[model samples]
Target: MVNIPRLPTATQAPQRPKRTDKQRKAEQAAAPVSQPTVVAKAVAETIKDPAFIEEVQARVQYDSPQGKNKQALSAYLDVLHQAKREEYSHLLGVDFYV
Candidate 1:
């Protein structure tokens, strides 16, 4: 038999296990409720303001990702976390530390 070149074994970074919907909801529920911060309020207002949104849309030459803005999604999340979400962000995943 002719000699065949050996190939290196493929390797991949381990993926974090996916949490079930129940688990996600439980974690979200476990997250403590806190008062919205002034910065969070400002961000929500700026993103929700019709005039500001319109101005930005007008300025954008390319198409926007959202038809419904749905900007409220992120706005609400930031408000819920008191704008501290980034503090717990890591390479693998989030820790709900906030």
Candidate 2:
């Protein structure tokens, strides 16, 4: 047998009321202001680089092959070349023929 304390049903802490729509809207509107805009700026900067975009597209293609075929091998090699070129360009800060 377990001994349990019995208390008056009327003795309880008050619960917080649900937020009103206006209060919720105010909170949502204020939430984004403090976050740094650096992520958006970085994304914008990244998209503006054609080399980076090409490299990314190539990588996606290289990784998503449905079958092992000559075409797939050729495409994978092409993407690898593009990735190397992008890396070299980034290192030199300028395009150079290799």
Q: Give the per-residue lDDT digits (tens) of candidate 1, residues 1-98.
A: 35457965666899999999999999999999999999999999899889998999888786444645667676666688864555556544776643
Worst 10 contiguous positions by lDDT, candidate 1: 83-92
- For candidate 2, lDDT tens digit of each residue in 1-98? 45457944454689999999999999999886666589998999999999999999887745444556767887778877998888889998999664
Supply the TM-score for candidate 1.
Answer: 0.29
Off by over 4 Å in 2: 1-14, 56-98
Clashing pairs in 1: none
Which residue runs does candidate 1 get wrong by more than 4 Å?
1-32, 63-98
- List TM-scores for all candidates, in order: 0.29, 0.32
